[model samples]
Target: MILEFRTYRLKPGTSEDFLRVMAEDSVPLLEKAGLRVVDFGRSLVAEDGHEEAYLIRAFSSLEEHERQEREFYGSEAWLAGPREAIVSRIESYHTIAIETSEEAVEALGRR
Candidate 1:
């Protein structure tokens, strides 16, 4: 399996709003698109004086990840749905995917 870790640097004062939109709107869309949507929320600590958050998703392979992301991000459900609410809060973001054990992913999910 592959585990994707996404980190977001949110605009100042937008963490609460962003997290709400993500939980309410973003996560359902991701799950509907067949993505794992493991976990996501504002970071407990901040860096460089900006709000921070992270999201994790599990996929069977990198190819599945790419395809699913392309389809989901391009679909109207995302573009017309939470896209604005989700993207507008972010100052920047980055994503990294790594190969890992199912056991490791399960351990992460337990957190």
Candidate 2:
């Protein structure tokens, strides 16, 4: 499986609003494209007070991930959305899981 990691920095004092919008709107939109939000949260303390959030999406393969991105950008969710207002900066990473160590996978499952 492949994981898509997205790190975000929200505008000052907008962490709560950002999380709410992500939960109510952004997440659902991604779900429609077969991208699952395995994890997401904000940092309690960060340099410059810039909140950090991340999402882990599991993909069947690299090709599937690419297809999802294409569909996501072309969808209505991307064309018109409140996400533009909430996110200040975004960094994305695509990783391939060579081994789903039992302990690691189990730990994540518990959460």
Candidate 3:
């Protein structure tokens, strides 16, 4: 599987609003497009009080990931609804070919 990790640096005091919109709207929309949201998180200690949040999306392969992105941006949800609400200013960082050792995967499974 391949994972896409997105980190959001949110305007201070808007973490709750961001989380609510994500849970109520964004997640469902992505799921509909076949992208699984593996995890979501927020920073506890903000740099100079600016909030940060992260989202991890999982796909079976790179091709699947690309296909999902196309569908997501082309969908009604992207054009007219939930996606419009949750996003403020977004800065995207990219990572490729993450390697997880077997021991780490086993340890995570135990959790």
Best candidate according to TM-score:
1
Q: Report backbone clashes per prediction.
A: 0, 0, 0
Give the number of the best model, judged by lDDT.
Answer: 1
Residue-by-residue lDDT tens digits, candidate 3, 1-111: 665667787765678888888877887888776777766767676766667777776666778778888888888867798765676634333344344444433343311
Q: In candidate 3, what residue range of length 10 has the lowest lDDT sum? A: 102-111
Q: What's model 2's TM-score?
A: 0.72
Displacement of residue 97 (Cα, Å) in model 1 is: 0.8
Candidate 1 residue-wise lDDT at 86:
91
List the lowest-lDDT window of 10 residues for candidate 2: 91-100
Q: List the residue pairs that clash in candidate 3.
A: none
Score each candidate by Cα lDDT: 0.91, 0.63, 0.68
Instruction: State in Å the error of residue 52, model 3.
Output: 0.4
TM-score per candidate, in order? Answer: 0.96, 0.72, 0.76
Per-residue C-alpha lDDT of model 2 across residues 3-93, encoded as one tens digit per residue: 5566666556667777787778787777776775566677566657566665666666778778887888777776687557444434322
- Compared with the true structure, what per-residue lDDT tens digits does model 1 show for residues 70-111? 999999999999999999999999999999988888888833
